[model samples]
Target chain A: MAADVDVAAAAQAEAAAPLKTPLHARHVALGARMVPFAGYDMPVQYPTGILTEHNWTREKAGLFDVSHMGQAFLIGPDHETTARALEALIPADILNLAPGKQRYSQLLNEEGGILDDLMVSRSLDEDEDGALYLVVNAACKTQDYAHIEARLPANVKLVRAEHRGLIALQGPAAEQALAAIAPEAAAMGFMSQRTIRVAGIKANVSRSGYTGEDGYEISAAASRIGEIWDTLLLDESVKPIGLGARDSLRLEAGLCLYGHDIDTTTSPVEAGLTWSIQKRRREEGGFPGAARIQRELAEGPARIRVGLLPEGRAPAREGAEIATPEGETVGTVTSGGFGPTLNAPCAMGYVARAHAAPGTRLDLIVRGRNLPATVAPMPFVPNRYKR
Target chain B: MAETRYTKDHEYIRIEGDTGIVGITDYAQGQLGDVVFVELPSIGKSVTKGGEAAVVESVKAASEVYAPVSGEVVEVNSELEGAPGTVNEDPAGKGWFVKLKLKDPAELEGLMSEGEYQNYVKTL
Candidate 1:
């Protein structure tokens, strides 16, 4: 009787918890296979499954409900002072960012390694109010906020955008879907953002995505997010995508996922993120580990990030050892997988500076077998962002 | 046609004459999602009951297929190396991983019947 009561209580608790998203009922109605992800019950795949969802994202439009990612605002007195305060904690050029523009940057530790990569967008209003909008990774949201709060000055504040729900509609037919729902969204250029009403739901829409396809990420109030998700899926081209397909799609695009391709041990220079650091920031030498980064920029870092093309059928997965022709271990594969578009195995890894060049032959040891590989260029499937 | 049996580890064995065809169950394939690669044991290699027979990798995770009965692996489905999705599409039919010449038919009694296998999957 006690065991049965415990089971009943567990079921009751699960039932009592509010199911997130406006489309939760729709997801269930469509027979989506749900899984727990980053504190939210999300669809990993629908009736079509992960493989079909992956292929659809590459060919058509795939709607991803990523409302679980953290959204917040950074407020300060002025832009310059606020940027400086932010640069002290992160490695981004928050000062030079013009209003309405967004920049992708990382929060770095004192050792110059990544804490998390986040997006910072300056608001478009006239006031020099350092009102910056940020979107951080879901898994590290709690720690990221705590770290920022502890390090920020009395004048600076980090406020969670708790009422918002973010969704990413990605792939080749994405623009069509967004245009159908909100015609004004078509004018938003790649990486550019705008505030618009998507199907009568107020949202901040940005032309950014993880699937290497033309798409937009819409952030709306939590109550209205599910409605927008359902509205978009009403279009013939749109289907729900899951985390399984998300990872494979990102891998194929040669994009880096935090906690996988990068960590606290990998510096921006070694991770092939030099372009994210602005010219003024590089010259001013004020950010964390600026001394080390400036030196590494001029003299070149010891190790560099490169894409690996594994020969034959087998995939060279994460943590696989990379070796030279002489059998000496040079580095390790950070992210690797089968590129669905390229129809071959592609990988990203760190190797000695000499081995970073494309066409450099390397050996990836997978399951005790040496898979012949070459250093290749990234984005195995070209990114079709609507620039 | 011989009666099919299942192991607790989620493998299925169908015996006919002295040969036994081994593969992962439908429930196992459903759990693995889309199988991308299948590493089969060498055709001539002998394996003991409950020993590792092959490696099956899906888009989500990797799983090892174990031998249900002691036998020498006489043949393997080389077609899986090219089309691994067969495991997910038709797990019980075309997705058979290997065929072994049984060393001991008595080992088959240790496996579960179809009814028992259904109950085992429910427990999972």
Candidate 2:
């Protein structure tokens, strides 16, 4: 769930030839167990394992080599053209996205289904007022670029930067260690973005992460990312984490994974991502799927994503069915696993609106047997993102 | 002498008389990463060789521990019910999934000896 949902395709890609990230050598040096993720050979976990890494990030700092995620830029003549071009594809208030600030939104189809979830950051550079930096899920990068390119005008170009390496340093101790390299990064407010020199290499740093924690994601030249990575590790508080803990951390934060939690068949409204739609977009209704999204926003989705707390230690894996106690199938789990922080099994899935409220009793059909569970408010663990 | 044998699926059984102590190999535990929970069969449950005898859940995924030999479950490892991580820490000792009374000790012949298993693992 940390990467692509179709792991079979990733496995076939690996068999053909697994693409290694810029930090592959470093991951191997740190004794990481690598697996094919989103067409790249990614570290699933380090020698310390996932639980320790998950808890370490909560108590200390955990470094993640997410260079496999796609980085790109949208170009136009000015902020209005750029934001407007992007708005045509996504349903976020891009025009209002202040410079140096980043916003989360989903790429939707005409049917109101999510094409992909991404982060759009208005460039902080005064000279580049027309450019927007975008980070998209790796597996969807190809189609996503094509999707945007087909829609935008000739002046608004899509620049896919496959040569950039993205690294996320997340945790409570992230600032304490990052300050040693780029002290300016420590001052950036949550969701703020800026370009700074990290370890003598110019990089784009964002005060945001998927981990629902205080963190920074540094985007640098693919070649120099290794240098930036090594420099950050010099601080003893940092430990290398991998996709395993990354998945658990994000799940505990109640964030949706693009391919699993939100897919082409799922709408933002059903995925509980109505928040990413700003008031203007909701009312103006210009973007793709605006009609259905606006209607769903007002009437509420028939089936909605909710958090499930399984009564015991058993994990309800993805694809598990959810049902009422007497045995009427209601929904299915999309992302379900153990929360290392809570030391309990928590899952996120779609259930009927009637069974979606917190404290609603339900049963998860795990391995064909019904297990007792209850709908719970998520961040199954409290979000510690530095506001 | 207590005889130890293994299945190609990475299950192991240490046979003492008609009693077999069953668990996964260290190689399996290594591949499984961190063990989060273990679902053991109930006492008196009869299992056939190659059938699911227990379920092991790791942080990454879940796998079924297959029975290496036909047997009736005698005692289950309660320690795993509380601390499933014991499987990763000490897979052979306290991590044994269940103790079973062999219904037919001859089923052990289909399993590999320690030396054969080590060589088999090398081939993998």
Candidate 3:
């Protein structure tokens, strides 16, 4: 009985401790500041600091360990079955998604609220047409998987690829840096995915990333991730960036961060992600919350997400109240920070439809003071994606 | 000769006559990462011991620089407005946030010396 109790206690302790990724040792060796994030002891920033890392990515290449993000595959008997199964949950028109292409979408509840935003990529190989690759945010993966599993038809299976480690190589020099190892990946267009040999290791490479800059997200076997990371860093242009710069880069790109920018309460239309939903999905009305989404598309969401440029050095961080010049509250900042590339404070927030237009004057209430801001257009820094 | 004292919060005050030049310790600047912005208190603003006198924002987050001892701010570092990186480059010298006219010299006894400060940081 005592032995069983001890074993139970040990299991409890193990579950409570934060999990370390395969690249944890490499991050430590590079003098990264480790912090708890998404149940993982992830690197927040390296000794080079966030500002330098942010600038380096804009000028050169930045490597990021995104292993904490959940990787999974939805498998069925054929492409149509699998696509239809996933379409029932998300509004993206997956059935028309060509092989080797990826589409971004969000899982929604019955009420049209976002469960989690994710990437769905169709298999590149014809023989594996039954499989669709999925990548979801780390913090929401557990619930996301459970939600997906419970709803998926018996013919389709959710295969969690927990053994894979994902990394993003991003910036102007990313292609050149990656071309040295994976020449085939360098030739792929944006949002394209394929199974390729990266540094002599078989891996899934996607010509896409959250940073708006041209980049690739490589998913390799956990055991070989360190080798891939090491080989990528050998290039003079490549530097290991942590979550800090990653957040700033995505915020500047005007991407929605799950839980912060979009949550269970925010719909894709409200978050300005309507572009991801194709015409077929919008008219057919088959997916969860399709009615509400279609209504929002025809009319407009009550509040819409927009890029906010605070008119000063002080950053209006998450939860800062967004108001009119007269102090009437219209919305709240979801993500805000100093953009190293812009050399200014940039943010994203949901404001009432009336105040969401670009160049509209607004005020952000930060620390009891009203800081002037303006509704700016997104991708604060122009996207450098190689089309 | 200037005698410097430190608080557990990592603020430092270098005393010369009745004036004290205040700034964050090198260790504090290192912990805060690259300083992107520094909000200095206005001159003539009176501060109490352990009270927040200025704000320091790094690339990741913002931190408050507390007053190590009570005094009236006689001067503020205007240079930080244009060059915040100076705090990371020379936190001990040019990064000085304010020059305070010491309200009570006895408060100095409550702070740590350089050696004590080093020992305290090691514990953290």
**Candidate number of the best TM-score:** 2
lDDT of 1 by residue, A17-67 (tens): 544655667678888777656556667777777778889999999998788
| Model 3 lDDT tens row, A288-383 | 888898999999999999999998788777788999998899999988878888999888999999999999999999768899999999999999
Q: Write model 2 residue lDDT over B45-119, tens digit each, in one string.
A: 999988889998877687899899898999999889999999998988889999989999888898999999999
- Please say which candidate is ahead in TM-score: 1 or 3: 3
Give the local distance difference test score of model 3: 0.90
- Prediction RMSDs, each to the true structure: 5.1, 2.3, 5.7
How high is the CA lDDT of each candidate model?
Answer: 0.82, 0.89, 0.90
- Summarize candidate 2's per-residue lDDT along A312-379 as a digit string, tens digits: 89988788999999899999999888888889999999999989999999999987789999999988
- Give DockQ for candidates 1 onward, in order: 0.34, 0.43, 0.28
Docking class of 3: acceptable
- Which parts of model 3 have CA positions greater than 4 angstroms off? A1-15
Candidate 1: residue pairs that collide: A22-A226
DockQ of 3: 0.28
Off by over 4 Å in 1: A1-26, A127-129
Ranked by DockQ from best down, the candidates are 2, 1, 3
Which of candidates 1 and 3 reaches a greater DockQ? 1
